[model samples]
Target: MIDNLIQGVFNGVSTGAVLLLAALGLAIVFGLMGVINMAHGELMMFGAYTTFVVQNIFKSLGEPWSDFYIFAALIAAFIFTAAIGFLLEKGVIRFLYGRPLETLLATWGVSLIMQQFVRSVNWVILAGLLVFSILYFGGVWALQRRPNWDAIKNWAIAVLLPLTLAIAGSMGVFMAQIYKIAVTKPWFGAQNVDVTAPKWLRGGLAIGTLQFPYVRLFIIVLTIACVIGIYLFLEKSPWGLRIRAVMQNRQMSACLGIPTKTVDALTFSIGSGLAGIAGCAVSFLGSVGPNTGQNYIVDTFMVVVVGGVGKLIGSIAAALAIGTTSYLVGSGTFTNIFAGIKPLVDFFTFFATTSMAKVLLFVLIVAFLQYKPAGMFPQKGRSVEL
Candidate 1:
């Protein structure tokens, strides 16, 4: 019983890592700007689509450099989503910043269009892309069970232990409001990842009874690096200061020579990029369908609120909490009993685990809002308001 409980906790923590990936960017966006981007999930879907493209690229080339292609997918997702997010900020989000309701409706419309486009694609190609991709968790599982990386695990714990905790409550995410890029590194040296792979790249590390896969480990490392890099950008840079200034008073920042609009576009792209990466991470775990982001969109919002608005720190905490809690009671019993009653006789009333979890999550978020509208760690200022 104790062993099972311990295992459950480990699983929950792993799942929480996934949630954190999705929620961190949302927090950054909302924290810096007052925009409630309804299209956030759609942005993530774009990333998953990037992974799909990479898979297809490999297949078309006869799987030339498989594992390397996974890396290519990640890079493509960041670039692709960032471009779209920037366009969104410039094209529509710029004008709709202060209008929450209008932004929601407009983005929702965009999401529907994207969904239809995905649905229109060839299903066979889609399956092949999702099934043969290197990021797939099944491949990772095979490597983790082998004997190696246990040494690394022992060392990583000391580092990850404090690192994870520090990230949990680091709600000063408002730092993005004050940050700016000092040395914008152009993407010129990026080598296109080939479609074929090296078997060694797809393995794992063991810790006691715990078995962690290489893909997950890669995800953990990449997420940490991004988080730390962004955090430093927000806290330690002069531009970060400008970003904060603009976030607090856009008019003042502009008066002070800060290009508020540029920051807004860049920030939106950065946040959206994070979502894209998360989408790519998830593609390896299951079917990379067009609707992949749909299942997670609501839950991501719930984390954003539960953790606190504009608070990346709060967002991370909320993501972990929600992921762990939702998976705890098991997706089975929890979903069947907690699912919302659908209007159609055979609809939601019939019961479905994943759907039920979502239903329960929505209800909980509603309750959380009633109690703490500002979330767990709202910003601190007249304009820093949630």
Candidate 2:
């Protein structure tokens, strides 16, 4: 019984670590910018796909290179998803700011589009589109910022627009040919893909009677590092300070030369990047599919809300509480605890089954929210007014 209890707690912490990873980005994004990013899950999908691509690339290189692919995949996933998030903010989210309903609808549409694109479009074409978007948007942004270029802007547009398109098109064709030569068949199609764990991460570590899987341990360690990194960035770094200032008072921050717009873009990108990392971590647990992100979106939002929006410590505490409760209930730990009491045993027995655990957990969350609607740690200042 003691061993079971210890095992349950360990399993619960592992589960909580995954939840924490998935919720971290959502908490930051929603807390900082009152925008409910419906497509946040899709960004995670992108990260998983990025990992898939990296895995294939490394595999093609040789056996030795394949073992270290995860490291490269993590970095690639972050940059890839961060770029997408930045483009998303600049292209669509920027215009929908302060309008929650529209933002939600737009992001939902984007999510659907992304999923379908992955299912229908070839990887080569997706790469081309990504390249095109980056170059085109980058050039336009640069042109827009130029001083007193209005007179020549039209001519510059006429020359630069086609040039950018031509260059991007050429690159796409070049990449496609190279891809065809290197990989005879497409790496990904409509079906899901699996990311195999490295040899080092396989199996479990034994501590007395309890066993801990390396993958779960890695996730826990990674989550701790991310939390610490974010804490340091927000507390000790200038950009993080700017982010907090903007979060506290956007208009005032802008007035004080804080560049609120840049802060928004940066914050969103970081959040998206974190989501990507979450996806990479998730890939180790199961197959990577287009719909993978959807699985965690609801739970992630719950974590953020229960923890109190914008409160990091609150998020951590909430994740652990929710995760542990769910695991304990599902594992019948609660039912066992009530075994000696007839009435309590019957009550827990009914609710402690795997299928019913989620229902019970949800009910508990609802009850908790009824008592503390602002969450365990509500934010003060202009955030409340907004």
Candidate 3:
């Protein structure tokens, strides 16, 4: 019984990892501007379609869809989506600031326009355009931030695979040489690991009484690394502090001579970049569609809303908790009476049945808001400063 429960946890982590990225973006956007970016999901959708386009371009040009192309696609998605984010902020969002309801409705319309535009056009053709828009432009935008070595390395690898591969190889060598690092088993499952093999020949592993797929391990580590990286950036770096400052109070920071616009742009880009990474990671699980972002939109929003508005670590915790709970309910290890009403609730039916997982999510967030409205980790001095 313990082993089975442990195995179920392992299954949950992979799903949690993807949610982490999407949730992080949702958290940042809502936390900073108090603007519910209804179109954020569309941004992710753009990223996925952008990736699909990049891969296809490689095919048409007789180039292999190598890691380099993927890296390029990541940059593409970040810029394509982030640029749109910046424009939305400048064109529409900025005007609707402090008006969450209006921003929400306005962005919803924007999202519809974006969706229909993509749905109308062959999303496949637009992917390459998005890629180029991101690459040549993203590189410049990232450099404008005067980022550190890691950020520099990050952007460089997106356009340069040999560099990224070398970095990955170097990390493996470093991890190998480092004195025995004791990898601990989580309370929920065994330690996570990254998959090094290509897709066709990867995964399909079994450990002990439980099957340990390489795919699940890969996702867990990816999610963990992302969460840690963002935390480190926020806690340890000067720029991160500035970014957080802008996130907390944009006007005050701008008044204090912080290049607030630049910070806003960078923060939005980082959020969108995380979305791109999630899209890349999602490809490992299934054939990604142009509208892949739609599937995760509502779920990710649930994570951020429950986690609290502006907190990064909160989003991570919320994602894990929500994902784990959803999985448990799905497995039917235990059932709450509200579970049966999910399908009905989902269809906007008051008494009809809905998907158990989503219903639980809605209930959790509602409960979270009722009890801890500021969130698990609300930004300190938020009210005091305002």
Candidate 4:
């Protein structure tokens, strides 16, 4: 009985760790920018796929290099997703600032587009080229709009820039396709790839009668490291200071000459990059798939909401609570507690036969919100104002 209880707790903690990892990104992005990005899940998917790509690259080199691929992939996922996130913010999200409904719809569309692009290797290359083209054209337009450029120079810039962009974009796509045909086809064989845990992550650590999986332990450690890193970045770094300043008062921050738009773009990229890291972590536990990230998106939103938007401590506490509750309830430990009351036991047993645990969890969350609508740690600032 004690072992079961201990195991349950371990399971809950592991679940909470993942939730914290996934939710932290949303907390930062939504907390600072007030933009509910429905596409955050897709960014995570990109990270998982990035891991697969890196692993395959290393595999092609030789088995000797495979072990270290995950480390390289983690960095790759962050930078790749961050770059894409930066472009996403610059292209689409910037225009929808302060408009919640439009932002929601637009990001949802972006999510769909990203998912489709990730559905196949061919699509991924094509999407990259498309994005490159868009950014290229957008830059030209911005340069054209600049007041410094005279008419002839502007015309020359416009003509030369588009031609250069077209050639560059076409060359990039052609090279990507060639690599995909020559390398990826023989190596990966398919878009759906399996990412196995390293040998070191297998097996378990035994403490008396209870054993914990190393993969879960790695996840817990990674989450703690991320939490500490984010805390320091937010509290000690200059970028963090700007984010906080903007979060406190966007208008006031802008009045003081802080570039709010640039801040927004950076913040979004950081948040998206964090999600990418989480996705890379997830690949250690399971297969990377097109919809890999969608599985956790709802629970992530719940953690952010129940914890209170933008509150790091609140997110941590809420994730633990929810993760533990879900695990215990799913494990049927609560059945013993309800055994003393026959009617309640019977009722719960009836519901427990299916997904009643999740239903009960939702009811509790709804009740929690009813009592404290602002969440466990509500932000007090004009930035959160809609």
Candidate 5:
């Protein structure tokens, strides 16, 4: 009984840690702007795949120190995810802000596109060129933010035009390499990838009567560390202050010369990067499927909603509650305790079945929300509304 109890609690904490990682990013973006980023899960998927790529690279090299590849994977996931988020904000999200339904729909569409992209590399060359064009001309547009058309045109011709052409030439060379791969590489077709955790993390830590998996412990520790780092970044750093200022009042922040637009883009990128980190952590938990993000997306959102939007402490508490209760209930701990009551035991068993657990969990959350719609820790100001 004691061992089971210990294991169950550990299970809950571990599960809650994953939920916290996944929700933290959503909390940052949703809490600040009231934008429901339906695509946040896909960003997590990007991180998982990034880790997958790193693992494969290390395997191909036949490196004995492959365990260290996770470091590279973590860095790559953060950078790639952050860059993608920045581009998405600039190209799509910025236009749809303040419109919750529209933003959600648009982000959902973006998520679908991203999923399809991983299954195909045939369009890489075209995508590369398009990216180059955007980067080159986008700078000119940024310079033209003040709307000096003649000056903008002159700058485009004198500077951006030549730079664009040079980049185009470089892209041509890059495309040739990609063309060769497209013609010859049979593995470029749509297929799912898998990631295997390093050998060092393959075991467990045993304590007198209880045992805990190292990977799960790594996840729990990593999550706590990340939460602390984010707290410092948001509360202690200048950029953090700028982000909070913009979130508190965008118009006022801009008036005070806080560069609200840039802050929005950076904050979005940071949030997206956090999701990427979650994805990398998830790679060790199970198979890195294309739809892995789909598994946790709803639950993480529930964490955000139940915890209270934009409230960090709320997210933590909700994650712990949801994570612990869901595990205890699904693990049949209560069912065993009530063994004498056949009907009650059967009822618990029914929901503990894999498919129904989520359904039952969601039903409970919906019921909870019916009474406290603003969540457990409701924000005090503009953050509570659209």
Candidate 6:
């Protein structure tokens, strides 16, 4: 019984780690920007797909390279999703700020488009587009410091136009050849793929009578690192201070010569990158699919809401509480405990199943919100207005 309880707690912590990873990015974006980015999950799917791509690339290299693919995949996932997030904010989200309903609807539409894009677009074309986009954006950024818009435009046309055409032509020819060779290949089809764990992570660690899987341990450690990194970045870094200031009072921050727009773009990018990392972590647990982001979106939002918007500590505490409780209740731990008591046993039995456990958990969260609508850690002082 004691061992079971210990194992349950461990499982709960592992679950919490996964939730925290997924929610961390949402918490940052939602809390700071007050934008309900419905497309956040799709960004996660992008990360998962990025990992899949990296894995395939490594597999083509050789056996030894495959073992190191996960590390490269993590980096690739973050950068790829971060770029997507940056574009998302600059293009769609930037125009719809301060209007929650419209922003939500717009992002929902974006999510649908992203989903369909993955399903319909060929893999090679998608990869070529990603590469082209990165180069195009990088060039634009390099030329952004020009003294005038005209100068920037001239440089872009003279330098970037030819580069774009060359890339497009090459990709077009390469894709045509590949298509001709393997017109019936499933790689060209939109389907789910698996990310196999490295040999080093396949085993479990034993502590006394309890056994812990390395994947779970890795996730927990990764979560801790991410939380710490974010904390340091937000609290100690100059850019983080700017973000906080803007979040607290956007008007005042702009008045102080801080570039609020830049802050928003960077913050949103970081948050989206974190979501990508979450996707990479999740891929270790299951198959990667175009719709993978849909699985964690609701639960992640719940964590952010329950924890308190823009409150890191609150998110951590909420994730742990929700994760542990959900696991315990769903696994019949409480039912087993109350087995000797007739009334309590009846109540526990009804709520012990996985689906019912979620229902009970939702009710509890709703009840908690009624008592504290601002969540576990409400913003204080000037941020209250925001």
Candidate of highest lDDT: 6
In model 1, the number of clashes is 20
Could you tell me which residue pairs clash in candidate 2?
none
Q: Per-residue lDDT tens digits of candidate 2, residues 1-386?
A: 67777788887887787788778888888877888898999888989999888988998998789889989999999899998999899889999888889989999999998887777666556676777777877777788888867877888878877887787778767876887744324446578999888888899999998888899888889889989988999999999999888878778888899988889999999999988888888898899888988877777888999999989999899888888888888888867776788997788788777668878888998999999998999888755875
Which stretch of 10 consecutive residues in model 3 shows the poorest summed lDDT? 183-192
Compare candidates 3 and 4 on lDDT and give the better one. 4
TM-score of model 2 relative to the true fold?
0.86
State the lDDT of candidate 5 residue by residue for 1-386, as single tens digits.
Answer: 66777788898889989889889888989977778888888999899988998888888877685877888998999899999999989988899888999999999999888876666544544555586678776876677677677766775668776777677667756766767655334332355566777888778999987889988998899899989999999999999999888877888888999987798899889989989989999888787766778888888999999999878899999998888888878888757766789999999888875567777888999999999998999878763454
lDDT tens digits, residue span 72-151, model 1: 88889989999888878876888988788888898888887767656543333233334433233343444457687575
Q: What are the lDDT scores of the predictions, listed in order?
A: 0.68, 0.85, 0.68, 0.82, 0.83, 0.86
Q: What TM-score would candidate 6 get against the native?
A: 0.85
Q: Write the per-residue lDDT of candidate 3 for residues 61-83, one digit (tens) a residue.
A: 65345434656766787777777
Per-prediction TM-score to the true structure, in the order listed: 0.70, 0.86, 0.70, 0.84, 0.86, 0.85
Of 1 and 2, the candidate ahead on TM-score is: 2
Q: What's the ranking of the predictions by lDDT, best on top?
A: 6, 2, 5, 4, 1, 3
Q: Point to the candidate with the largest TM-score.
A: 5
Which of the two, 1 or 4, has more TM-score?
4
Per-candidate clashes come to: 20, 0, 7, 0, 0, 0
Query: What's the alpha carbon RMSD for model 6?
Result: 4.4
- 263 Cα displacement, candidate 5 (Å): 1.3
- The TM-score that candidate 1 achieves is 0.70
**Candidate 3: residue pairs that collide:** 342-354, 343-353, 343-354, 343-355, 344-352, 344-353, 344-354
How far residue 181's Cα lies from its native spot in candidate 4, in Å, is 7.4
